[model samples]
Target: PVHAARLTYEAMRVGAPARRLAKSLQPLAGRCDARLVYAYADHASALAADSGPRLLQVADEMEQIGALRYATEAAAYAADAFAREGRQDSARQAAARCRALNARGHGAVLPAMSELDNNAVMLTPRESQLVQLASQGLSNADIAERLVLSVRTVESHLYRAMQKLGVSDHHKL
Candidate 1:
């Protein structure tokens, strides 16, 4: 069930058609697992529906279940939903909760949130892609080669991405 939820969540994250898959997994929300797969399923469904309120509810439930990782991921999803809805204050609150959870060492940071600024502003797509590669320890030249771009362009992208993410260096990415 947890694996199904994770697969659904990944599908939704990529903007794939996951509404049917999420609906099919809705019945598992009552089941128990070490990682609280039920809550993860609910969160994934809410994401598929673009429902911020439901995501927030799932985040609260995840916190109660001691699933800090899922809680933070849900909060980050809720933050993004709220931002898209023009609810800046609510988005900020959710993002702050996510940051607090990470700061307390409750769980690993969500990969999607890794490229956010201190205030949870999202990085551009190019910026996010560059940051992900750099975080994997790829050098500018290597990234350039892989992306089929000039080394200078790769460095520029990394520099701008790092600046937006508030990282002083690529090593920090």
Candidate 2:
């Protein structure tokens, strides 16, 4: 019941929530109760509506974790898939699940899911902050204002972050 409610809420947005849920939870198919199975289906439907390709990847992961019934295995599969695909939408969804499963409630399913690879040159704290904001799609002017730095400074930070990450633009980050 609790899981159903949670799945419903998650499916409330972007439609086809159930599809994503289904694919993501496929590995737990027989292990989960009817309520959870329904919730998983609903979530997969939701994912399908928002991003079909991503849901496909989620389904792939679910298949990999086969009958494990462990959140860590689920998250590990997600993180690994996200790393391989570099899909922001899927990574975000997987990250959310990892965080949720790590919470005090929710059975504390996954304690140490593998961390996503961060294979880039290091950034200073300020540069890291700027990169974070940039990844969120904030404009240079907006980021500068928020950080109380000049636009030129913000641009410089962005430039440095991109260089360190071995990328030519912000989108790669």
* Candidate topping TM-score: 1
Per residue, candidate 1 scores C-alpha lDDT tens digits across 1-173 of 66666676667656666577677567655554545666667777787787768888887888888776767777787878877887766776777677666655454656756533433445567877888899999999999999999999988878876655446778977
In candidate 2, stretches whose alpha carbon ends up further than 4 angstroms from where it belongs are: 1-120
Per-residue alpha-carbon lDDT of model 2 for 1-173, expressed as tens digits? Answer: 44654454345332434454556455554455654454345435434454434443444444444423333334444544554555655554554454444442344333324242231133578877888899899999999898788999999988976765445777655
Q: Residue 126 in candidate 1 has what lDDT?
A: 81
Q: What does candidate 2 score in Cα RMSD to the true structure?
A: 12.8
- Runs in model 1 lying further than 4 Å from the true structure: 1-18, 30-35, 118-173
Reference-based lDDT, residue 36, model 1: 63
